[model samples]
Target chain A: MRTLVDGQPGTVVPVDDRAFLYGESLFETVAFRDRQAPLWSRHMARLDLGCRSLGFQPPRPEQLLAECRKVLPESGPAIARITITGGSGGRGYWPAPDAPERRVIQCRDWPGEIDRQRSAGLRLTISKSRLESGPVGEGLKHGNRLVQVMAARECARSGHDEAVLLDQAGSIVEAISSNILLVVDDQLMTHPRPVVSGVGLGWLIDQPGLDLRLRPVAGEDLARCSEVLVINSVSGVRPAIAIEQYRFRPGPTCRHLQSLWNEQLI
Target chain B: MRTLVDGQPGTVVPVDDRAFLYGESLFETVAFRDRQAPLWSRHMARLDLGCRSLGFQPPRPEQLLAECRKVLPESGPAIARITITGGSGGRGYWPAPDAPERRVIQCRDWPGEIDRQRSAGLRLTISKSRLESGPVGEGLKHGNRLVQVMAARECARSGHDEAVLLDQAGSIVEAISSNILLVVDDQLMTHPRPVVSGVGLGWLIDQPGLDLRLRPVAGEDLARCSEVLVINSVSGVRPAIAIEQYRFRPGPTCRHLQSLWNEQLI
Candidate 1:
C-alpha cells in the first residue's frame, strides 16, 4: 500500500495524535478505478459531515482528491482510504485548541475476490456483539470502532464472510462494515438514520430509478425479506446468500442495484 | 515527553495500527515519584482486565515496568503512560490473527498545580454528553474514548476544571477522566460496576482503613452527599467544589483519603 500523511509520503503519525490516544478521527474509504475515485464526492460529503459532528474543519475536497490521486495506481482497481485525525495534542483527552488536523491517505490493491463475493454472494452470521447507540458520532465512520472490530473478529472466527449487527433494542443496524438493504415484498427498505448509515448506502439511496423506503428493521422483518444486500463504496453491492439459517437467492432487485452500482465504475 | 515504543525510544506509530485505525487499544497512566511508579501493579491489573475483555494477550508486567523505568526521570515527580495497541494490520477492522502487540511508554513532567487543585478543590460542571452503556469494554480504559473527549471539550468550553458524566439512565458514571466518590452520611460510596469505574477509584476502594460502599449513584444522591471527590492515577484525589448548581465542601473524609493516597508517594 502507498500512503501519504498530510499529502506527503509517510506511514507514521505522532503518538500524541488525538486519534491515536482517544479515537478522535474520521475516515472514508473510496474505490478507485483508472486512477480516479468515482465516489470521491460522496466520501467527502460524509467526511465533511463527520468533521461537522466532531467540530473540526473539514479538509478541502480538492486537496484530499489530489492526495488520493497521488497514491492511487494509474490503471487498476484499488481502495483509497482517507483518515482525518484531530492531530497531535498533549497528554489528555481535551484537544489543543490550535491542534492541526492530520490527514492520511492510503492506496491499497483492491481484493480481487471481492468481485466474486459480489456476484456469488456472501454467507452472513448474526453477530453476538451489538452496536451501541446514543453516541454523538453514531452513524459517522469515526475512528472509535471497537464494536465493529469485535464483530468482524467474530465473523472471522465463525468463518462467515460478514457479520450483521443490531442496535441495543435488537433492531437491525447495519453489517459490520457496510450498510444493509432488504427487499421486502419487492420494495427496497433500509434504516433511515444518517448518523448510522454509511456514505456508500447514502449514495445508493440517492441514485435514480430505485424505489427505496427508510424505516427501522427488526430481525423478524429481515426474515421476511425477499433478498438482502450489503452496500459499501469499496465493494459496491454484495448479495447475502445466507443469514444464520435463512437462505436468500440473489433476487432481481439485488441484481438491478448491483448493475446500477457497477455502472459508475465504467 | 520521552517515549519508548515496543521498548525502543520513539514518538511515532504506524498509521495502520489497529489502535490507530479502529481504537483497538488500551492504556494505563501511572503516577511516578522518586524514580518508582508505585501504582504500576494496579495499572497492570486493569490493563490485563482490558486485554481479557478485548481478547488480546496482556504484556508481561515486568517488561512494562522496565520500559516505564527507562522513560521516567531518575528522581522527580512524573507521569508514565503505557499504551498497548493491537499493532499494525491490513486495511480492515478485522485484526490480523497474529498481529503483535505494540506497547508505548511515555514519560512527561507531572503537572505541578495538580497538588494545589487537590488541596483547594476543583470546579466541576455536569457534562451534556452522556456515556453509553452495554458496550463490551465499557469500563475498561480502551482507546475508544470519543465520549470522554467530547465531555472534556465541553469542560474546556465551559471553563470548568472537570466535567461529571452520567450514564444513559442519568446515573452518575464518572468525570471525564476520573472516577467519582461521594461521602454520603460519612460513608464512602461509589458505583460498583467495573465497566464504569476507573482504576484509580478501584485502588482507592482497595486501600485499607477507608470504608467504601459500591452502589449506583443518582444525581439526586449527590445533593445529599456530605462531600464529593474525584480520583485518578495522575491527580490521586481531588475534591469537587460543584456539580452544576450543587455545591460541595471538602470534608474531613476527603482530607483523610488524600492523606492515604499521598502516603504511597513517599
Candidate 2:
C-alpha cells in the first residue's frame, strides 16, 4: 500500500494534527475494485457528515476523487481509507481563527484476510458493553473511538470474531464495527437509533420487500429470529450463525441480502 | 519548540505509532520551570496508569526522565507531551505483540501568551455538553479527548472562558480539562470517580482541614455553592466567580486554597 498527500507519493502529517492531539478527525473505509473504488459517493457523504459534525471544512469533492484515483490499488480487492482532521494550530482545543489543513489518505488491502468467514459465516458473541451516544455524536463518525476499541478488545478476549454491543436503553445497537440485521419471522428487525447509526445497514434497510422495522431488540429476541446478518463496507453482508449459545442456520433473508450487496457494488 | 524522536531531533515519526492510529497513547502537560518540571512524578504516574488501563507497557521511569531532561524547554513555560501507542501491525483490534513505540514531544512554549485570567479568574458558563466516560475509561486520561474539544468550542461560541461538562448520569463531572472543586457551606466537595480523577486537584483535595467529599454534584447544587474553583497543572487553582446568573466573591476558603497551592508550588 502506498501513501499520498495532496496527490503525491509521500506525505507526513503535521505535529499538531487535531486528530493526533484531540481525535478531532473523521474516517471512512471503502471497497476497491481493480484501481477503482465502489461506493465512493456514499463514503464521501459520510466523511462530509463527520466533518460537518466537527465544524471542519471538508476538501473539495473533485480533489478527493482525484486523490483517490492516484492511490487506489492496481490489483486485487483492497480497502480505501480516507481520514480528515481539524488540522494544525488549533489554540489548544478550539479551532483557530485561521483555516486548518485538510488531510486525505487511501491505503490498499485491509490487512485482515476474511475470505474464510465470508464463505463459511462467523460466530458472534453478545457484548456486555454498551454504546453511549446522543445528538452531539450520534450520526457522525468522528475520531472519539475509545469505546469502540474497548468493545473490540472485549470481543478479542472473549474468543469471538466480533461483539454485539448494546445501548444504554437496553437495546442492541450494532456490532462493534458493522450494522446488525436479524430476520424475525418474515420481517427484518434491528434496534432503534438510540445507539450508533450504521451507514451501510441504513441503506440496506431501505431496500423494498425487506420488511424492515426499527424496534428495541433485546437478547431474548435473538432466540426468536430466523437468521442474523452483519454488513460493513469491507465485509459486505455475511451471515452470523452463532451468537454465544443461540444458533442460526443461513436463511433466505441472509442469502438474498448478500446477493443484493454484491449486486449493488456492480 | 524542539521535536525529538528516539532521543534525537527528528521530524518524522514511524507510521506504526499506536497513538497515531488507535490513539493508544497517553500524554502529560507538565509546567516547565527554569528547565525543570516540578510535577514530573505525578504526571508520570498518570501516564503509567493510562498505559496500564489500555494494557500497554510503559517506558522505564529512568528512560522517560532522561528524555524529559534532554528536551526541557530553553525558557518560559511549556507543555511537555508524551504519547505512547500500542504499536506494531495486525489486522484485528487486539494490541500488537510487541513493545509499542513511544512519541515524545515538548512544545517549546505555548504560542500566544496565556489569557490574563489565570490569576484574576474567568467567568465560566456551565455547558449543556457532557463527557463520554464510564468504568473502562473513567480517569485514564487516554487520547480520546474529542469530548473536551467539543466543550471548548462550545465555550468559545458561548462567550465563556471554559465549560463544566456533565457526565452521562447528568452529574457535574469537570470543566473540560480541569477538576471542579466547590466550597459549599464552608465545605469543599468534588464529584467522584468517572467525572475525572485529576491528579493535581486530587492531591489538593487531600490536604488537612480540607472537607473534601466525593459525591454526585447536581447542576442545581453546584450553582448554589459558596465558591467554585477549577484546578489543573497550568491554571493551578483559580476561583470561579460565577456560573451563568449564580455569583461568587473571593471567599476565605478560596483564598486559603490559593495560598496552599502557591506554597506547594514553591
Q: Candidate 1 - CAPRI tier?
A: medium
Superposed by TM-score, candidate 2 places the C-alpha of residue B116 at a distance from the truth, in angstroms, of 3.6
In candidate 2, stretches whose alpha carbon ends up further than 4 angstroms from where it belongs are: A110-112, A194-196, B14-16, B74-76, B92-94, B108-115
- Give lDDT tens digits, candidate 2, residues A98-175: 656556575756546466666678888877766777426676666666666667777877778888877766667788
Name the TM-score of chain A in model 1: 0.95
Candidate 2's error at A65, in angstroms? 1.6
Backbone Cα, N, C clashes tallied per candidate: 3, 0
Model 1 over residues A210-246: C-alpha lDDT tens digits? 7899987887787789999998878888999999988
Model 2: per-residue Cα lDDT over B126-230, one tens digit each? 777766655256688777677777778888888887788887667777897788888777777887764456777866866788778887688778656888888
Scoring model 2 with DockQ, what do you get?
0.48
- Where in model 1 is the C-alpha error above 4 Å? B194-196
User: How far out, in Å, is residue A6 in model 2?
Assistant: 3.7
**Pairs that clash in candidate 1:** A139-A195, A139-A196, B139-B195
Q: Each candidate: RMSD to true structure?
A: 1.8, 2.4
lDDT values, one for every candidate: 0.84, 0.71
